[model samples]
Target: MADSTQVFAILAVTLAAFVWGRFRYDLVALAALLASVLLGLVPADAAFLGFGHPAVITVVAVLVLSRGFERSGLVDLIAEQALRVGDRLILQTLVLSGTVLVLSGVMNNVGALALMLPVAIRLAREHDSPPSLLLMPLAFGSLLGGLTTLIGTPPNIIISAYRQDLVGEGFGMFAFFPVGACVALAGLLLIVLAGRYLVPQRAGQASLDAMFDTAHYLVELRVPEGARAVGWSLRDLHQAIEEPVPVLAVVRGEARHPGHTFHGHLRVDDILLVEAGPEEMALLEDKAGLEVGPEPPAEDGDGGGDEAGTVDTEGLQLVEAVVRNDSMMLHRTVGQLRLHNQFGLHLVAVARDGGRLNQRLRDIRFRPGDVLLLQGGEGEIGESLATLGCLPLASRNLSLGQPRMLLVSVAIFAVAVIAMVLDWLPAAVALTGAALASLLAGVLTLREAYQAIDGPVIVLLGAMIPVGQALETSGGAALIADALLALGRDWPVVATLAGLFAIGMLLSNVVNNAAAALLMAPIAASLAEGFGVSPDPFLMAVAVSASSAFLTPIGHQSNTLVMGPGGYRFGDYWKLGLPLSLAVMAVAIPLILIVWPL
Candidate 1:
């Protein structure tokens, strides 16, 4: 017998702390673990064992493999093809959702979603449609797709590892595929048919003429005599100017090459056809010691220029870009990163979460959600933006760099997954080897590998494992299971399974899904024993429910990520999400009973 009072008290306090949200979940979990150790609820020697658990290794391995797939640009290639289908809104949704579902089954759903997002935005812009209608459906599709495989989501891995510890065997690679596929198909159908109605139709029609906005200015630069520009051809000058601007034309006295050649040679008196705004033109003139020709005529209402041909400074404009979570510039400060010195762009202002920021630009640490307002010559800014991993407010031409080491990255990742699946090596060893190989082969740097992993999630998992073990050792799980069984003595096995599923779903919404699964699995087994039935169905029910957290933005990282971009309020999610959640519950309960019968 266990002291029920002490166990319940600890449980209450932990749940309260999680709901508070003031402290980090990992730190709270660690505090709980230490408290348990002090109370002698868990053995001190066994306290840290969960950090070395197989589930953790499997999760880490899956993350690394997902990163490898993303770096290969295979997902990007697929998304580009999806964009070319030119399907109707309904048909486009079906195609995009279906593609993401299939791709996510083979790779990480988050990676799949990230690759598809730009395509979704592009489609929305093409059709003059609101992204609100498509983005939520895509996010839901990514979540549903994770059900198709064992390594599809962290919850699945935790459940499978837990099962192995209890029953001496784990789920096979395709164990969950049949039922999961059915659920995913049904979910996809619902979103395709009814999702449009659920989402607001706020997208008004856009004019064809206004499709491409000329927010950037176009100006011409002239090469001066006895200057560096005099000896350089347009192509050489374009390459030498390491800014965002491009050389659009080359005017040589009476002759002009509108379709400029990159290899064209230069000589004295050659009028270099260069395209740049005032800022870049100024920079070029200063750097190469060249001079500009007479300025173009002023507007009808504006006063004429001075003898030296200076234009109004008011014509210059600035644009802002929000730094996305996936941006390489996330965590760097403006000065440390040297945006101005290296890229020839100046940071004028930054906006965070819709609020104007006044922090010193140099001292401001860049986070994923921060928006930067920059002032620079528009042409050079666009090209330099690529090197900084920043997306432009307007669509600009992009250069797809050579995908060197892509094949080596794929091969190494394949070997790691194969080694783990074949039981030839531990998953941790395989993934560690693959991460190192990627670095050695120059597929990803060590810094990039670290950046790819979600630190908060890892910490939450590591800290909560010890706390979950404490709950089990203190007989908390058994007590809760017994109480539930007593209350539902007359209920059918399916009803008991449903109740367990509901509890798991609730717990996952509040805490981390892996932690919820680890804490609930043993209790589910105890409940099955009390009812004199197989525990497999009940455990599977818990597993599915734990991973199905679609109600709130905070329930999943994907939900949180789309909140800002989709312009969604906290309540907007449950409009479509509530129905989806209920549908999953209704379908999943029956499927669990049919597939793994009690």
Candidate 2:
């Protein structure tokens, strides 16, 4: 009893931390594990064992494989096909959501969503529709797709591992197909038919100019003959400015130099591409003898007038990219990253949560999902983005296909699936083997493979698993199970199942889905024990509901990834998510009963 009380206290604090959103989830999970160890609820020797758990290994391998799929050019090929479909909203939604759904079932859902994001944004631009109309549905589709396969999502994998510890056999690779497929199909229909309408229409940062409204801030300053600034170095000029105005580039006649790296002294006719508001623009002219020059004409297809700073010169490019969750830039300011010195990229402007950041460019710390407008050498921009762990917002330009590599990657993935289906090897071993094969086949570089693994999520899974075991071993799970069982004693067994499902769904909305499963699985098993029924139905309920985190942006990384790019506020999610979640619950319960009967 005492141990259960302590474990309960630890979990309560952990859940509170997760909801507080001040610290990372992995940090919260690690704290929970350490607290349990200090209280003697979990032995110190066994606390780190979860790091080596099969579920963690499988998740790591899956992430590497997702990157392999990306490098093989198969995903890009398929994206090209998706773009060819007519611009009708329903048809576009169906194709985009359906492709992500199928891809999510095979790869990490977050990764799958990342691959499809550019395609969805392209569709929105082509149709002249708000990206808000498409991104939410695409994010929701990623969640629904994960329901159909054991390896489709972290929750399913965690739940399967829990079952293996109990019964000595985890669910088969396709075991989730019967119920999961039906639920996914129903959810996709909702998104295609009516859910798209629920998405609020907002002007997102869908285009280069749309993101920063750069014309308002980006101005040109020319150095006239005999001007006081003519002999000033770029560094000296920077010291003269009062406000944090970044000089993005310097055009001397036809030659363009990146301001971040320019060491040459200023000269007459030097056209400075400066990011500054009116006051700073005035300050530069008064203090440095810099006069505002005529705005540079917009590039073709830029719709000209007032679209300053939206041009690509002969050798220079302005690209928009979003920082990935695992980006090195997280919590690091532009100065710390040395974007100009190391990568030769200039920080032009930044947008987050539907608004432009008001801070100076160098002081603005990068966060995951921040859309950045960068200026860099045309030849180096693509390589720099990959190195920085950012995804370009624009569609990639690639040759149509690389048949040989694509075939090899697909063949390796197929063999792994076959091995899992035949029980020739455990899911972890098969996936690990497939990842190795891809590495040897040159599908992805070693650095790319390592970058693909989401470090925070791995830490969360590794740390939470041991804590979840402590919950069961200390009987905390049984204590909670008894209280719930007693309340539902008069209800039918299905009602208990429904209650468990609802609890899982609500909890997932506030925590990581994997953590939600880790915390809920033990209680679910205990409840099955109290009812003297097989744990299959109960575990299935927990798995499905945990992945149904559709009510909030913070509920899932997929939702959060699209929040800035889609221009969605916190409340925007529930508009479509609430109805889709209810639809999923309605379809999942009966199917769970029929498929995994008590």
Candidate 3:
């Protein structure tokens, strides 16, 4: 056992580090763990064992299974069907949010949010509604749904595992679902009825078609005497140019061939009538030695208008795209990737989740899932993005064929979840099997499955597990629990539960939810023991509170995911979230008492 002073010191430092925001919670946990080891509080051999714990494996497996659901397009199909049911804003929110909430109860909340986000974006586009109003509700719904099931959120799983260790039995698969369902239903009703009034209305009213304007321009590329373009028709050039831009016309020997009739083969002296603007022309000229044709008149504007009311379509075009996690272009700095030199497009502004980029252009290391506002020639932008393994924001012309293999993917996932839940197989083995099955079934490729996992989150979790164990073994949790008990000796059990819930919620705002839950669960358990009550209620409180992170962008992945797309401000979350959180507390406290009696 650690000395009281040592335990207090550790708790203080951990809390301070968590609130600082300068260091990641995982690193802080690791640091605390190392301190405990050096202080002789935890055994060295057992220090790193948390990485292999069941909770960790369960979380990872859930993430993988979630990815399979996404790749199979099952979620998208559901979203499409739901949207076709109505056009009323309130009705749409009710249906979409309710569906996501129900799905999240059975799957990972993060996965549920990821699956529903595109659908929400599509709905916002269709209704001309700002995503801001809809996204927060969806994020809240996802969080609420997680409260309903053991596997809904990582924090819930961790708390359940901790309970099993302490009392020799943990919550059953649907043990908390009744309470969670009521809470989710109440919250969903509040959002659908009055959420729009609370959440700010900031999404501009712009048609999706009008928002993404492409600048068209004309330029000429010279074909070497022996190059592939020497004898190819203008239609042949279409395949060579990258996406976002297509050749509209061909100019050869002073005669401009409209794209529709330009089918003749090219000769050695033929100046291939290429259609590209300054940016596209510059890239091709530099890369393939293409020549720029005479500049077109400034007023024939390809549609880009300046602040001075002059449209200069020939000059440049601005486009916006959200960076997908699967994008190969992530993590590379613009200068290192030579975005302009290689792709012929300039990186003007980078919007991360929803935060602004005030940093120097060279200093920004592009993260996966960042939204970018790019500027360049319209014709070449799409092609450049394709080369970078990115999908355009605009709908693709490709058709979704009948997915005959979706049933196989679904069966594999269902079996994996059953095996893990039933304790017949390790969670990791089940998920790995599911991922492999997805690849074999052609639902997603091996490369796609690998890309589905978020590396940073996995690394952060692995590195922090040892640290969380150190805090537990070092008696840090005991010290904090004792302090809370001292302050509320005469308070009711419900009050104590509420205090624990509030503390967990506050901590989650600053630190990762998993780390917050791991740190707080033991403390809540200690408090329960001090009061001579069952720890189950307290543990449930911690689970629900840790996952209800609606106050800040950094608190939850779902919140961060919608930031850039919704164009929300930092303060916007609290406007809707504060009341919602309070309501959750009011409803959840009573539910916890009734569901898990003290």
Candidate with maximal TM-score:
2
Predict model 2's lDDT versus the native. 0.86
Q: Residues 1-598, candidate 2, lDDT per residue (tens digit)?
A: 4998898999999999998876778888999999889889889999899999999999999999998998898888888899998978999989999999999999999988988998888888877888888889999999999999988999999999999999999999999999999999999999999966798887644443477655556667899887889889876886676344667789987778777668899988899888776567777888888887765554532454443433333343677788876567878887678787689787777888767777777678887678888887778888898788787876667554568989999999999999999999999999999999999998888988997888889999999999999889988899999998999899998999999999999999989999999999999999999999999999999999999999998899898888878878889888899988899999999999999999
State the lDDT of candidate 3 residue by residue for 360-392, as single tens digits. 555687754466656655667776775564434
lDDT against the true structure, each candidate:
0.66, 0.86, 0.68
Total residue pair clashes for candidate 2: 0
Per-prediction tally of clashes:
6, 0, 7
TM-score of each: 0.70, 0.93, 0.76
Residue lDDT tens for model 1, 1-598:
3554565676678778866655656667777766777777767887777777877766766676677666666565667777776848888889888888887776667767766766776787777677667777887888788888777777777777777877887765557777778888888888899889886543431211122122222344566666776566543554465443444445567775532233466555554333344566776777665566546556621354333343323333344454543455666776567665577665655545334444444457775545455555666765565456554443222222236655776688778768767878655576668877877777666655665665555666666677666666667778888899888888877777889999988887776677678788888988888888887888888778887777776565556545544545567778888888788888888988898988
Clashing pairs in 1: 243-380, 244-379, 244-380, 244-383, 245-379, 245-380
Q: Global lDDT for candidate 1?
A: 0.66
